[model samples]
Target: MGTLGRSGIVRKPNETMRMLVTTIIGVVFGFFIGVSFPTISLTKFNFPSNLIPSLNFTYMDNAWSSVTGHRQVNSLSGVPKMWVETNPRGAERLPPGIVTPDTDLYLRRLWGKPSEDLIIRPKYLVTFTVGLNQKTNIDSAVRKLSENFQVLLFHYDGRTSEWDEFEWSKRAIHVSVRKQTKWWYAKRFLHPDIVAPYDYIFIWDEDLGVDNFDAEEYIKLVRKHGLEISQPGLEPNSGLTWQMTKKRDDTEVHKETEERPGWCSDPHVPPCAAFVEIMAPVFSRDAWRCVWHMIQNDLVHGWGLDFALRKCVDPAHEKIGVVDAQSIVHQTVPSLGNQVSRGITLV
Candidate 1:
């Protein structure tokens, strides 16, 4: 005799026994499978202690030319002699303090390497572009910088006659005023060495000075924050208060759209700040890509770089970082009356 329920099906004792076993088996099997397949980790990985000791930075074959208009090959080690001399300015031979890697300034620039075990100097491609119309401190700046960075100077003559000057010879490309087309002014031109890679590219104005600026520390923070575009706090030329736009506060942003109904609510956009100036903007490779693409070759005379950069840093795609620890001096020459009003869209 078998018990029948509303389903109108009666299970024999053997059938019932089989059903019970199968249910038990299914639960056990599922447990085993779950144990075998552990959950995946979503957290980003950082370099382990052991691995950090073994890593080294190098340039990919002939990578320098593409980034800074140098077409020829370049070696990465044995920094040029010009960089090691203490008296870069020759005003007076700086005490070994200026050139010594162990000095406080050097360590600060290198970001506090207590031992070689913690030091990781990522390779970089750096450049400076100066236009003829502006007055600049080219010689002193170059000599001072050659100590830590390899720089290629691009002069905007007309486009055809532009040449690149390196402290030492290498296969870097040069552009003249005529041939110095709009693309050269784009961020991509400053970082063409795609094969041998640098983590960051510093494209600065010639009027800017890098006093007390520590490159190594700057790089560490830039890498850690993973900012696409960033700047150090600026100091005004008059020695008055330096100005910078306040960062977008997440709370203030919410209030903004509530106050102004129908405000273009873009989850992807970051709030526009007070201003993005062009003094010494630091760019990660990611920032460079977006900036390079937005540059309009048609606007031949450099005008919209800052706006373009500002527009490119979307909250959904990139982060903006500012460093307050270090500052660069802007040699404020009075603006020669070319009141170029920057209408907003881009840097």
Candidate 2:
């Protein structure tokens, strides 16, 4: 019977066989040592914290550490992990701390005075689209509107110096941009967010005659009727096509008025009710925000915007109206159009 070897294989008991078995065991052990030596050697080298694979943090964790200037410690491992600290505070305090009356006077200089004094801001604002040639008409309108309204003139003629001729111009803000349309100036300059401090905004053309319009009375009617969007009534000879805009002697304020046949079936719709022509539109601050967004950036002429104004206000019929008590005449002068066309052709 043959004897079993250590590997449970039957082998002949020869010197050559024993020598071959010992050599095979040495070769196998040496191969494992060679493979493990490089890994052990790599652990001895100290790499940067960022290069270490196990120390990497998630994007959110990194962001939190950067903003708060605190390192994210591993809760489970209880190890101090390396992280970015953007606003590091190392034995230093932040300035402008707790602004109380007892604070040092030198430190208080960095902060402005407390809000104890009353600041009287303008209640209403009016923007007039004016040309240099219409200075006479603008002066007349400003004279009547300046007492109660904060006037802002958008001079399309590019002749800003001409405003200096009128003494009332001292109270107005004149912005002169040449050859641009009224709506163009309005979109670029009269943002609702900037003008939110005012209660009402009047966007009127320069040709309008405001002899009959009373700024104070108009605001009173607007508040009483709860009109978010409104305009003064146009005189009969104002060349206005909409019947709702025409001056009504019977009522002080009218939301819905008669229009030409087939103009609008629903009286609650625009051009009949819940509408005011763009020539002289007044908007509440909240309504103006919506309307300012609705004004297309490319549509500079603003011809079709009046029809869409009602969409910005809820229950448009009640909130939008024409105040007959504060009426004006739309001279319907084509001077702005004529000059703009000429300027474009010249360019």
Candidate 3:
């Protein structure tokens, strides 16, 4: 509407509408500018998680990345990955595309996928150096282990076929190399990277009487006590070579035992503390890695390895111990000991 006045033509309502439109435009412009240019560095400061409403955290990450050219959280899935899960080889996965350093005893169908494991992966690995004579004892020992454990048997007497009589033998991995000592086989086959998938590794003798030992329960105790290197306590009367490995009737586990006087200079050292017999020792994945490297190629029988095991673990008294609740009979079979010819020229 226009009106004639001393000021010539006055646009009354039109001028009021113009003023209203300008006010609205100014408010909108200021709001967009404020959001676009934050006063603080978005990358340097961690904003309160709930500061923004109706926005996805990932979207916010992307928005911040787009604006500031820096993103603190790299994960595309919204939550930043605190650590990356990789193959044991890490970024150096090359050449062999089909297989990983980690292996399993799971059997696969010949016609289809080589990988039978998609859902279930065995969490632990239990290995035995066995002879046909100890089949019954080995059966009892394997039965003690749960389904979470994968069995691998090293046949020193070259009799893998006889093990098939047991139903579980079909699934058990057999590495038959006649007359080789367990340490020889371990050095070649159980490389740290090769067995990286297993949380714990049990390298045991076939003659162990495992009636009182439960592998799952033993693992629970090991974890509870933070034992990196351990063994089931030997029966008090069973070839009780070392006092540290002997079962104590009063304790669930024992780290130190009184040795014969004048034998040990330090009570906290091996054969008194931080000691486990090699016959039925169980090693954590990390401990085994260090022990495997310590194993010498020529020293096949693992002479003096019982004391050397203490070197693999620091504050050895704390990390190495015997679980008395799960105890085994040593049975001290002379299977490997009989190879006197090789033991003489052993390398």
Candidate 4:
């Protein structure tokens, strides 16, 4: 997990709760007497507080409800550090482990980068860009993505808050972009200190939600197909246009034939929607280097970025692949209009 901002330094974790109180007597008496419950600060909703303010009668009743809904107390002696439980949406319980050597070998072959002898670890760097004076659901979106993959978020603002708790524990580094300028955001992506350390980079918009995302598998697929540019799972209803091809063979209709149209990229695999949505797209070092060299220094802001990058990558011929297995839900609003008038026509 990671986050960045204007303070120029990664923000520190907020202090833990200063107080905690659990009283059966007070709870029973208050329940019978219908007493007014205590109120909690809005900041406390995101941060830990001294006491868990009234779950019975507080404006933050929802928060109280969520935090205390379930509690399981179990005492097991000398459990292995590697043990973990599955907290899936439903059917919550500790599942079995992949104890087979074949499973371990598959995992190693899938994501592990080449290391001495036999150790393999995937290398990745995640980059996020935020504009100043913006209100967004990005923080929550990022938190969800960080559960399985290593993530780093860059914020334009410098304010520290309790909501940043996950970043502190997850290893997200907060870097100040000074201003919310697109160039600054782009610059940090290429900053030697940042780029030199990672093998793969995933750049994305802030408002993207990954409902069933798994970065390890994502990378594995990318490498397996030998693609330099790859996109996350996409759905056609998401408002992005894709070029698809239709195959016709009426003479041979088999039982397996559903009589449906299939879609795909054009001969020159240029992206159908925005190239590099700046949200949830992964690029190999080879692709990033290709982009870095082609970016025109003067082209700094948002207008022509998508256009310039597509041209830079020579997308029509690159090993650009799209994954249909997983989908990232982008919470994007309707675009006002095309901001730049580059003469390129959309085929």
Candidate 5:
């Protein structure tokens, strides 16, 4: 009877332990099935329908809201519609219909203009990068550009004060940063949205001699020919690299021309046809918007950009040309390339 009683006690505990283990295994298996096949309705598991609503099935949505502090609205199909976040600090927001100032305040301060005053909007905008040593060349170019275009100067030498020596400098918006390439400055400063008001944009090197180039005449020819990407014809003896860019007396603008030995033979190809060297290229505001996107942030010198300029304008041959009517001499100065810092060329 004592042995029978001991056996009964052990059997009762073993049955209880088996039941407990079965319950845990059932719960783990259900959880895994629920995760693995989300399409299965919770109601199929005999769970109370009301319990499903109380539990968060959209954990991702809840987590996203918690981290961003933004409430997300989901469609009946469970797709997110929009995310809305409210500023808890209660800072005043700008009222509707107020104009946000787009002009760079640092550039304005350099121009010695009041912060409240609006910048003078010009029909044409010209930009160039210069060193302190190239003041003479810049002075000539700025003088020509200032006649019809609002000039913006990017001084690589960082000598903003030295520009005071030139009379035309007073008319320009000057920004100076030391030892950076023209493309580097251009990427940061010449955002298309900011300069959208201008009809044309001329981005040129400071070394170009603009004695023969007329800013007014150049615009007239560009508008006449509908040239979206163009440059002044380089004089035949002015270190002529491309035959297409060299001046031709027969026409005002040439779209296709004979290329040098290394240039592409196909008239449709660039750096041979529909190409202007980046040294002194003019862009229509629309073309500038597209070209600005092509300028890589790390490619400061813009070495191979000429080949890609055709991508910005369709029928590039028709829209891109050399304006021989307003030719300019490329002095080809190595001013920017000579600046070496820590055995690396900055230009």
Candidate 6:
């Protein structure tokens, strides 16, 4: 695993990956602690004399990153080499393999230009939690998004290869696990650093109908209105629980929609104002960084998150709303609950 930057540079493994390096650092540091006030300087760094004022922790952190960030471990000639972990430990452990939290979906060629040549960073990310039955819906939705958006599908039904029929499928990312919610997959795989390249992120359910939605146009409205957290207004339907998300056909967006009796004590509060259902919410890059941290591992998808999304942005009421000009039909498919009933449990 190499550390990748937007510049398309994939750091080669740390060349000085010898146990002697570890042993030397450990021994030198131990000697410093042994002494009452050990001061070493750059002039006498080889043996550690009483000249250095203090340790440069920044240098040490870089060293640690070099040692742990990549798979390369023992280099006899102090020359960095490319390596791949084909037989991985899988998810039995906390991180399976590698300490780095960032990753991408670019397929690598065995022998060609440097891996950096493969970086085609997209400006946005649109993720869907899907099952086999929702293929038609997801395919249609993905087609509506421009090439600037990266497509990531979380396969809860464990069916991924079937999506290869689409030409775009060759470029998208797919993560398949038997039965899990999109929130779970987001927390685990969509680390902020991994998706930092994108300007916006769409974490949506697979049952959305994008027939009238244009991802690029939706983004334009989100930016034009200075919205940090937003969603496409829901097409008129009986399944809606909040009028705040319903499409207002005459407007570009609706920040404050009238709620039913006693549903919202304050018109500016959640479930009435600053509200967009979790089913199809779009978050700015900075907003998602904060929202991702707020997600609890135990939270079942879409149960109570729609209200708290306002916390991620400044001026919540002004920045959170529904874009009516670009909207989608929520199919109200039973994905999480149906999968859980088969085997998984809430408790």
State which candidate has the highest lDDT: 3
| Local accuracy of candidate 4 as per-residue lDDT tens digits, 111-229 | 44545433433367665655332224555545554333445555555442433555432345455543343444655456433464456778766555666566676777667765566
Worst 10 residues of 6 by lDDT: 36-45
Q: Per-candidate TM vs. native?
A: 0.44, 0.66, 0.69, 0.46, 0.68, 0.69
Rank ordering of all candidates by lDDT, starting from the highest: 3, 6, 5, 2, 1, 4
Q: Cα RMSD (Å) between model 3 and the true structure?
A: 11.0
lDDT of prediction 4: 0.47
Error of 2 at 149 (Å): 1.9
Stretches off by above 4 angstroms in model 2 are 1-120, 338-347
- Could you tell me how far off, in angstroms, the CA of residue 292 lies in candidate 4 after the best superposition? 1.9
Model 1: weakest 10-residue lDDT segment is 251-260
Candidates in order have lDDT scores of 0.48, 0.76, 0.81, 0.47, 0.78, 0.78
Badly placed stretches (over 4 Å) of model 1 are: 1-122, 131-136, 143-148, 158-174, 178-184, 187-196, 238-242, 245-275, 310-318, 332-347
- Residue-level lDDT of model 3, residues 1-347, one tens digit each, is 57666878676887868988999999999999888755333444456768854545555555655665333444566544322123234533233344456664565666756565344678999999888888998898888878899899998878888888999899888999978888888999999877888999999887788778888889999999999999998996586478888888898888998988988889888788988888888999999999999999987667689998998889899999999999999887765554446347332
The 10 consecutive residues of candidate 4 with the worst lDDT sum are 251-260
How far is 125's C-alpha from truth in model 1 (Å)? 1.9
Worst 10 residues of 2 by lDDT: 99-108
Candidate 2 displacement at residue 131 in angstroms: 0.9
lDDT per residue for candidate 1 within 72-130, as digits (tens), equals 22236633222223334442333445543211111223445456632433365555555
Error of 2 at 195 (Å): 0.6
lDDT of 5 by residue, 88-189 (tens): 233213222343434432234444547545455468888889888888878877777645578888988888888888777776788888888788988998
Give the alpha carbon lDDT tens digit for every residue of 1-347 in model 2: 56687889876668557878999999999999987753232323567877775743355455555565654444566544443333233312222232221211011124466442224346788888887778899888877864546788887778887688777686578888776777887788878756777889888888899888888888999999999999998988898468888888999999998777889989899888998898889999899889989888887668889899989998998999999999999998764664646447311
